[model samples]
Target: MPVARSTKAQSIKQPRAGKAPSVTENVPPEKEEGCQAKRSPSSPQGGPKKRSAFGDITNAHKNQAVTGKKEGVKAPTRKATRPPPALVVAKNNEINLKKSLRKTPPTDVPVEPEKDSVSEEPVQQVPVVEDIDKEQLGDPYASAEYAKEIFDYMREREEKFLLPDYMEKQPDISRDMRAILVDWMVEVQENFELNHETLYLAVKLVDHYLVEVVSMRDKLQLIGSTAVLIASKFEERCPPCVDDFLYICDDAYKREELIAMETSILRTLNFDINIPIPYRFLRRFAKCARASMETLTLARFLCEMTLQEYDYARERPSKLAASSLLLALTMKNLGGWTPTLEYYSGYCAQDLHPLVKRLNFLLTYQPCDKLKAVRTKYSHRVFFEVAKTTPMDMMKLEEKLKS
Candidate 1:
């Protein structure tokens, strides 16, 4: 991919504070397998029954699925009383993870906060953010009406799949071992031409399973492979078969063992595979900011690094994404947080500082040998060679914080 030049954001209208989120969260549309109708045979002999390369392992239960369009969520007009809407959780158990952004006290620039507080914060309103979906009225891929609602539901679901420092529970395996496994999984993703989501979800599966079950060092690869197998089922159009994964392992694990492990992971996690991933959030946040492809790729490179580190295992995916984009903007000489980004992302530039500083540190320095998967991957021309971009100075980060 050609390197994307940095682009200035369009002027943001004054941001009015959002009201309590009242959206009815909708899940993303399910992907349907495209079936090609077979031509009627010349005689009474029937054509072969439809089967998949992977035996439709992704849809073993949905072989006879109907082909019907899902109902789309309807968009609402801007309300006179309400500014832009916040993504409030519809479920009682769901907790808000996106903290309202605290203004980063500026050192050089005097950027104003979105809203001024006169006891209840009554000041000026430029243009309140209309629904983000309004611009793409008829785009099915964008899901314009329910995009925010869908992401809100994802934040709520993040709570259920949160992981503690699972390395403490593994007697035979250490963080280093897990790091190596993730590095290898990155290689697998590259080899298989898998989607980025597949890699992320596979890592999530591994962490979640390790939380519930103890395993030997040798079987760790087995667990990782099975997690990838399961993630592929969810994220890929045509995922690799059992044999493909087994072959990658050099026959270290048996087909039955891989299948058995898949059963265990699903049971342990209660079959809830719709876990929120940072990659999806990064894309959304980058779009909201109107960042350049290079800037977005840089942010992606930062976010991908966290996969190798056990420290960020429990960090909220939304927060990680917001932070990564914030740092990327700053790095590219783009202005700090804008009202539109703050409103849509539910985070201020300051809210991202802790992660921004840490991610900047990782980018500034050379990663250790085992954890170089992300850096090397991004170094290639297709990724805009973002890994080669200069890192922000830690001193500069401190100066920003002190302000």
Candidate 2:
């Protein structure tokens, strides 16, 4: 029994052959005691001991220091280390900046050299023509502002007084009779020394009244005379008296008859007698052409001639004026339908072609017996004798116009 007990104890004391030894089992008692002392809860250091790999490393360092002290081996004191690469570079840059600030900086700005003073000679200026007295300027209608207003007013009122197809509507009054009436009215207007606007308004009133009320051929003269009277009163500063108009009419109508016709004409026209005339347009277009007095008078002659033609009653005042001026320009050997004229008159050569041809025919070919009033009136030297000046041959004019 004692031998069996000894063998069993030997077997128990021996380690298992196949299994690996544990870390705690392989460590020496002294090393384990040191590890336990470093990790103790009641350590000399202030904080509680940490159970980590870093703590193990710190405990190993402490053990090395203690072992060195016990062995009396002197450990070398650590010297101050060089700073990091970035911090070294920053210190060098700061030293460089301080050294640069201590030195004087060179100025990059440039300086200009002074110039020698020189005396200047006085300049001689010519006297301007505009310094002359304004009263010496004779053109009252030359103001651009007033001219613009006149142009705008005429354009606005032109469409209002346009003559419709009076020939188509009136059965009693023939075109010839209408022509005769206008011709006689022109004489009356000339006799009264009335304004050109007055003459045109009077003719317009006659046509406007005729369009609304059909009148006898005999009463047509009275109608025209009454229209002139109404127009003179409306447009003229010193209009002719009713007796003067009656006297001009050869006393064919009494004072009451004249007054009755005037009332009848105004009432028929709805009292709207502010008519636009070709004469104003002629003046404007003549200025655009830079035409002479003779040229303008010729254009006026042609325009006045159109008043007698019943077919021309449908033409616009601006168009008629442009055509007349173009015809006069062509006849006077001046340039025909230039760009300057087109700019102001708003009519190109192509646009003025047909109207110009018609006017040329009226002046050259139309019989002198019927349209005698305009011809005779313009034949005088007072009119620049534009009526006596012959128009260009129609064939040659057509060729030039086509080209």
Best by lDDT: 1
- Model 1, 280-333: lDDT tens digits are 999988888789899999999889888988888789888999988888888887
Clashes of 1: 2
Task: Look at candidate 1 and tell me the lDDT of residue 314.
Answer: 87
User: How many collisions per candidate?
Assistant: 2, 0
lDDT score, candidate 2, position 282: 89
lDDT of 1: 0.72
Q: Each model's TM-score?
A: 0.68, 0.63
Candidate 1 residue 345 Cα shift, in angstroms, is 1.7
lDDT of 1 at 274: 85
The list of candidate 1 runs beyond 4 A from truth reads: 1-130, 400-403
In lDDT terms, how accurate is model 2? 0.71
Global lDDT of each model?
Answer: 0.72, 0.71
